[model samples]
Target: MEAGEDIRWLPRHTVPDDLVFPFGGKDWWLIDDRLLAMGHTEAGRVTGHEIIDAPKGSHEAVALRNALWPLAIPHGEYRP
Candidate 1:
């Protein structure tokens, strides 16, 4: 599916300069502020994916969402 159609996209500039790209470390998916699906990395490559049952409104989830919010631009407004 297309990004704007199935999922939102953010421009690279929206990301914080100090934050390492997930592709450079570990990758994760936070869904609905609840589920956390993380991707394991080995030798800079994704090795596997795991899902964690994170609850919505949890401190960790909320903190993560807040940290990411400032770095995200609306999908419709993102350039490049």
Candidate 2:
């Protein structure tokens, strides 16, 4: 965080527990407004990933991430 001027690092621990994730609870990355990269994990271990074309901008993922952004702690402020 010391040098993260242009990037916002929102760590997961500070987010509230009320976020309802889409994509079957799989971890996801909204890679711009065109692609969504989803990771398939089992027992906290990675299995594989799926890259889906999202022409409509991955509305669900975008919403969830936006919702999480404000709720999460900035990387510089997180103690753990």
Candidate 3:
């Protein structure tokens, strides 16, 4: 992207009952498939990052990332 963002995606809309942001509505990144760096947010702003070790729950995080990948729309194609 012109903004230097490698990839931008708009998540597909889904029913509220479905799992979304299962990690306490916080933003997160699965680092090298080994650690989960979850950001704690307040008013849409990140306040801190908490790292989750792989053995603790990285597997579930991986699965969630995999499941959501196909549902994400590239920034260039999203409508809303």
In angstroms, the error of model 2 at 27 is 0.7
TM-score of each: 0.54, 0.64, 0.64
What are the candidates' C-alpha RMSDs? 5.0, 3.6, 3.8
lDDT of each: 0.62, 0.68, 0.71
Q: How do the candidates rank by lDDT, highest first?
A: 3, 2, 1
User: What's the CA error at residue 29 for candidate 3, in Å?
Assistant: 0.6
Tell me the tens digit of each residue's lDDT in model 2 across 15-55: 55775557777777776645898899889999999898865
lDDT of 1 by residue, 19-51 (tens): 654333455666666777778988878888888
Q: Report how far residue 62 has shifted in candidate 1, in Å.
A: 2.7
Residue runs of model 2 more than 4 Å from their true location after superposition: 1-13, 75-80
How much is the lDDT of residue 55 in candidate 3? 63
Candidate 3 — what's its lDDT? 0.71
Highest-scoring model, lDDT: 3
- The deviation in Å at residue 59 for candidate 2 is 1.3
